[model samples]
Target chain A: MELYLIIILVLMILGSIYSLNASDLLSAVISYGIVGFGLVIAFLLLQAPDLAIVQVVVEVATLIIMIAAIKNTQSKIPKMEFKPKIAIYYAITLIAALVFILIFDRATGCLSQFGADTMRMAQPYIDGAQHTKSANLVTGVVFDYRAYDTLGEATVLFTAVIGVLTILRIKGKKEK
Target chain B: MIIYILCFILFLVGLYGVVSKRNLIKIIIGIAIMEYSINLFFIMIGYIEGGTAPIITKGFEHSKFVDPLPQAMILTSIVIGLATTALLLAVAIRLYQKYGTFDINKIKDLKG
Candidate 1:
């Protein structure tokens, strides 16, 4: 399983790099789907079937929307302007990434190794979940244990839809 | 732990795209990539080597369950990511309609 995950993770990185460097917008979006689908698989491998399902569904919708967006405007990516500023930006990003990883590695030294969750907070969920009587613990957690979180999620989705409609509106101002 | 570093590298790839890309759609793709990495990291964090799914069944009620808290949190994050992506695309389309191009470099007047 680890071998398979390593291969998938490497492929996902390749896909991300290709999407960023692709000249064609449609193909770039397609490669982005590769990253997303790879993610769905990773979720499944990690024993999070619920996440895999949600991710797969969302990935398809996102790909379709992105493809539609590119179709509406242009499919050809504009040639990147070569500039000294861009080189500096690259240097800065690379340095920042290195610094970040170093700090993160040092900071997480006290962290437990993978697959050994301390269950500091999750133990209660695991113990109390049986009372909820939901076979699927994830569903129980989402619906019963964290109802307010679900409500917030719904509100966010509603707000985003409204925002999209407003932004795409044909008319924003009244006629004078 | 090494896998976690790899995941963070994926995130760096996304960050690089957002910082360097001139196209709006590419930036959105980068943002999506970043979101995926974060979600994957969360799920990976909650993973147990020998644990089964968190579902409590008839006989497996006493079995080990992977952390359910992160799964629930990531569930919401995924939906929110979709909304974020949609809103971003709509904005990109609107920007195209108004400017007649997807290149941010051409939209110079709005920069100031």
Candidate 2:
């Protein structure tokens, strides 16, 4: 029953997104909304209600911000349209989707055993960890086993913000 | 199976939008779509068939409990997504204020 519902939901999402190709701004907006909502639903169905909540909230903010930006930047500028060969694109995409589905199914089946084994082996670590109070294995992995990587990632984000602000500040000074 | 294929298709369409669209906002939409697709993919990864909710109860045994780890991982990812989208929108707003247009073709003042 759940599988059938999932299939229907998937179809609805695909149909809505495919409709985004229409050369209409309203269609684009509606399709994007559907896509975003579908993603949140997909997350919920996949046992990640936390992600679903986050995704929905973030997506709403993103769409609103983008729409505001789009409205502000309103102009009579011509929209760029793709002129790809329709048949070729469709055929390629269909084939690619099929191949991707097949690969995912096969990989999932193969990885299931490995995942169980890994989980069993890690049982001891889970049992022994003092940080189990955090109630998050990925968090434990992030801040413990790969603290260096997390630190580097933080550094990168900090650097990016500083760089962008510096550039914008220079531009502001020049404009004044 | 079909759900997996549909997700891939959605991703491809978003990719096409990002690659082919010249409007900055459209490109941003494409990027947002891609982020969503990945988020969905990650969620799907942690699901167990016929899995019960991960709530603990006294003296109750459940053989089919969903893994809650991916949900936790994605919680972080979603916040990151929010930060990224906010930053990107700010950049877009700044770009519009400076350039007076969202067309990538027209916003080529820095092309020296």
Candidate 3:
């Protein structure tokens, strides 16, 4: 199982690297889908079918929306040439970021090994779930024990809808 | 350890794209990548080797299950991520419509 996870993670990393470097915007977005869908497989392997289902559906919808967005945008701007200095700057930043994450990971060093359950906080959520009378623990956790958190998520989604509608309006305020 | 490190590297890859790329679409893609890395990391943390899903059935009422809290939190986070990505893409489209180009450097007039 761990091997399968490692393989999927490798594929995701490669897909992301390629997506980031790809010259074509469409191909880049398509490659980004690889990372998203790989995550779905990972979720399944980890025994989270609920997440896998949600992830797959959301991934497809997101892909459609992004593809539609790119359709309207093409051949407009002169291709920006990379100045040698910016490339060098990016290289430096990349290396610096790499070093930073490594050092940061090492310094924290708090995360346990994969699949090791050292949880001290989730016991009550699990042991106390019988009172919720839900067969599915995750759903019970989301919609019952933490209903307010779910409500907050709903509010964020609502806000996002309003913002998108505002931005995509046919006209932004009447002429001044 | 390697897995965690690799995940962080994936995160840095996204960060690199977000910070270094000049194209608006690429930046959005970068943000999406960053979000992917994070969601994966969170899900991975709750994994328990050989554990079943946290659904109780008639036959297996006492089966060990992976942590449900993170799963629940991540479920919401996933929706939140989708919302954010949609909002960002919408904003991207609006910017392109106004500027006629996806290049940030070229769209400098909106700097105020």
Candidate that scores best on DockQ: 1
Question: For candidate 2, lDDT tens digit of each residue in A14-69?
Answer: 64465445455445655677777766666666555556666778778767766665
Per-residue CA lDDT of model 2 for B1-112, tens digit only, reads 5555565566766776787677676677777677766766555555667664444344424344455555555665666666566667668778878777767877886545
Best by lDDT: 1
For candidate 2, what is the interface RMSD?
Answer: 4.5
User: Can you list each candidate's DockQ?
Assistant: 0.82, 0.37, 0.78
Please state the Cα-based DockQ of model 2 relative to the true two-chain complex: 0.37
The candidate maximizing TM-score is 1
Regions more than 4 Å wrong, model 1: A81-92, B110-112
lDDT of 3 by residue, A1-176 (tens): 98888899899989988887787888888999999999999999989999999999889988988888889677333455779888888788868987897796886488788899766877787787789988899999999999999999999999999999988989658776
Output the better candidate (2/3) by TM-score. 3
For each candidate, the alpha-carbon lDDT, in order, equals 0.88, 0.60, 0.86
Give lDDT tens digits, candidate 1, residues A32-113.
9999999988988888999899999999999999888878665776676799988997798779999988887887777778
Candidate 2's C-alpha runs over 4 A off are A4-12, A15-27, A75-109, A112-131, A134-171, A174-176, B55-63, B108-112
* TM-score of candidate 2 versus the correct structure, residues matched by position: 0.70
